[model samples]
Target: MAIGTLDAAAAYGRSLKTLAPAIGESTAATEQHAGGGNSFGSMIETMVSDAAGSLRTAEAESAKQVAGKGDMIDVVTAIGAAETALDTVVAVRDRVVSAYSEIMRMQI
Candidate 1:
């Protein structure tokens, strides 16, 4: 009988080795934020807030431009930035949910 060169245990061990740094960083972050409840929640909230603020600024600038007191470039930039931020947040949320679903499907 011929033996395959691939070793499942070795492959698993290599994967663990590759993930060691990430696991350590996560552990450190958890310890650092032990008092805070869900750092990711706060991060998402902050991102949404920033996007909302950008949209508000763009709205104000548009009103000012209508009144002949604002720059067209600034208004366009603010709106574009806000749109990008909102899109990014939605993409991140989708990816996170997808990853969670995949993890949940994995058998322990």
Candidate 2:
């Protein structure tokens, strides 16, 4: 809604490109011994996998706390981590959507 939001989104998109090659190199290493595909896709896959794992851990810890088998501090920590992961995923999704929209707006 604001110019600053667009600026931030663009910045994040640029940052993602900067990080992509590190992901690509790791993906290339694994794929070289197996087969090959898009490293960007692999990077996204890894990101989603990690986010899901974080949410699962948070749920498990909450369950343990409910059952009185986990410490409150540990449960809180896990939930906080999960929340942060979810926030990051949401932010990335927003940036991706913003980038795609900008791409579609090109006169070409």
Candidate 3:
């Protein structure tokens, strides 16, 4: 891959690692607030939404750079990260939906 792409991936990885603890804490707090009745499906949905938001922000930054309003490397990196993040979110959504369908199809 290109250097910009690699850099973006690294940055995205770091960002996820840094944010994970906070996300987990918030998720836990949300579950506690709901008296522990929060479903895994809802938690996954929330995470996917968060990923989508991050991707949107990255795409905006990338667009600004492409318009000559920002750094080229930074812009390229951000775009790559955004695309990857969005793809991941989409994949997770697909998996979750599939799992839900399967559960519904059970004979129980």
Candidate 4:
């Protein structure tokens, strides 16, 4: 990866952290008062599904490019982004499952 790209990725990750609190606040408010059917878990599931779909699309596009229609760099970048997003979702799922199991095992 180019140095500039690495820097940009780092900046984007930092920006995401800054947005986290706002997202959490909005979610909390919605849960408490919106009366909507949306829950945090459902939102997370939707995000995961979207990410997976994006990954599949990226892969398909990349494959098509190998047949000589798309730009290699764009395809590679899309695949990388999708892979990273999937990895993040899996890590979050593992952590949530582990925490639930631990809570279940606690003596109350």
Highest lDDT: give the candidate number. 2
Candidate 2, residues 1-108, lDDT tens digits: the string is 555433444454455555656666575555432332455544454556677789899999999999989999989999999889878867877888899999999999
TM-score attained by model 4: 0.60
After superposition, candidate 3 runs with Cα above 4 Å error = 1-42
The positional error of residue 7 in candidate 2, measured at the CA in angstroms, is 28
Clashing pairs in 2: none
Write candidate 4's Cα lDDT for 10-73 as tens digits: 4544444456466675765544333323555444545566676778889888888988989888
User: Residue-wise lDDT of candidate 3 within 1-108, one digit each (tens)?
Assistant: 455333443454445445646667676655443342465534444555566667777778877877879887776777787777777766765786699999999997
Error of 3 at 91 (Å): 1.3
Each candidate's number of clashing pairs is: 0, 0, 0, 0
Per-candidate Cα lDDT values, in order, are 0.65, 0.69, 0.62, 0.65
Q: How far out, in Å, is residue 91 in model 4?
A: 1.1
Higher TM-score: candidate 2 or 4?
A: 2
* Model 1 local distance difference test score: 0.65
The segments of candidate 1 whose C-alpha lies over 4 angstroms from its true place after superposition are: 1-38
For each candidate in turn, the TM-score is 0.59, 0.66, 0.51, 0.60
